[model samples]
Target: MLPVEIKSILEKRAKDGWVPEHEAKEILKIAGVPLPKSAFAATRQQALEKAEEIGFPVAAKVVSVKIVHKSDVGGVEINIKDEKSLEKVWERFEKLEAFEGMVIDAMTPGMELFLGARDDEQFGPVVLLGLGGTAVEIYQDIAIRMAPLEKEDVLSMVRELKGARLITGYRGKPSVNLDALAKAVIAFSRLAMDMAGAFSSIDINPLMATPDGCAAVDARIIL
Candidate 1:
């Protein structure tokens, strides 16, 4: 069974087919992710279809072999309202050497949060929860737990962050669905544990904890 919203998006994409991105981009778009408009170098016609499926107020970025984190390298554009912004960025991006091709996707909206998994030689897989923002590094507000976690463990980690009080339900929000975020965290942990040989770390920061759900806006799988 699929959520009404996600099933609709997937069906639309399935009908149109998906453009394949490098392993870097694909790692960010997991089986559980739902996007308003997410495509992997999809055709122009398919891009329009995805836009319709996901709706306006989208985002587009450059996916290249040389780069993985778009924002880190100034390859990301966000909150694209009209198609004009889309073409404008696309053209400018094409001229830029840092970018290879464009990755068009729907923009997600909500509060920012962080989750990560790291394989420790001594501890095996460990999960992390951090207070997200421009000051994530300065503040360094994060909590950690061992992997292969239960729902209860995930819940505890989320609560461990003092900032999480604001993330959960600070301003008339429905607690930002920590359960949903927790499930993603646990799954990421399991994935890290399963694929430990391939990477040293995985980070999903500024994960939007929306009223409806959560989306990993940014990710890094260090290999």
Candidate 2:
């Protein structure tokens, strides 16, 4: 079942027809997907407190319903290790249009992966997996499957990727936990099935795949 808070966020954002990143993360958490510790703050003091609570060396992004490409608008800051830097980033984000708040979250380290779903007239909901990061567009290495995937389907999809070798340890890099990744994929597929027809598209980009598990570090839901 969808959490009441998540349902409320979806409903409110539906008026605008899109769920902001922070709210999208909250909804994904319900699917048992891992996420970095995070908090939302609407004021400078609140941002500082939340940042402190979340710890040093964190990242911050603007939480605006109107702002889609946050980085383009200078609404994102990373490697924030002290109150001074956090304060500065907060001030910068406050300058953006429709500035709602800031999301302060831990800096999760790992190899990036992508997971997404979109409503398809013929397929119902289609799930996508790929090598994620700023280069996802450049690389264009991805695989797809229909929603509600079984374990075998998920495994096959992963192996089909051009970057599949990366997950099994490439060169000196350690292999990521495939079991954990599989679980995350299954959870995302279930979420797609459950929320089918409600969203035009859902994107979980750069799902940080660490030695332990994958974390949905960023997300978006278009209604």
Candidate 3:
């Protein structure tokens, strides 16, 4: 059963055919996917307040249903360590077309990775794991499996990545907890299955994989 909040979001945006980053993250949160502390701010003052509440060194991105690739359009600002920097970002973001507000999140350091799922016409739901961040397409290192993935299936997907060594701790870096990552993946798969027809696709880029666990740093849902 879809949560009332999620159902309401879907119903409201049904005609838009998409969900903004802030709302999409809410859906992922309900599915038990780990996420960085975040809040949506509709004004500069609110952004500052949320940033301070979440603590300094945060990332802010424009929230708009019309905008898909935020970075490409300069709608993203990261490593904001002070209120001044956040205000600057807010000024720039407000100028962008269709700008709604901003989703501010605490900065999380970890190995960048990707988790995504799409409702395939033939396959039903398909989940993907890969090297993420902005270079996801350039690397093209990904593994895919049908929905409702098991623990073993999720582990295998991780192993299949060409950059698998990175996750296992390469060059003396801390190793990410595969068990915890598997839990996140399984939860995401469940979300895919549960929202099968409710959405067209979902993307969790830069799903930060850390020694302790994983977090979805950014996400998108096409309704």
Top model number, TM-score? 3
TM-score of candidate 3 to 2 decimals: 0.97
Per-model clash counts, in order, read 3, 0, 0
Question: For residues 9-59, could you state the per-residue lDDT of candidate 3 as single tens digits?
Answer: 888989888888899999999999999999999988999999999999999
Between prediction 1 and prediction 3, which has the larger lDDT? 3
What pairs collide in candidate 1?
A: 36-54, 37-105, 37-106
Better structure of 1 and 3 per TM-score: 3
Find the number of clashing residue pairs for candidate 1: 3
- Candidate order (lDDT): 3, 2, 1
Superposed Cα deviation of residue 208, candidate 1 (Å)? 1.0
Residue-by-residue lDDT tens digits, candidate 1, 150-186: 7888778777887777776866656777677767776
Model 2 per-residue lDDT at 89: 88
RMSD of each: 7.1, 1.3, 0.9
Mark the regions of model 2 whose C-alpha exceeds 4 Å error after superposition: 1-3
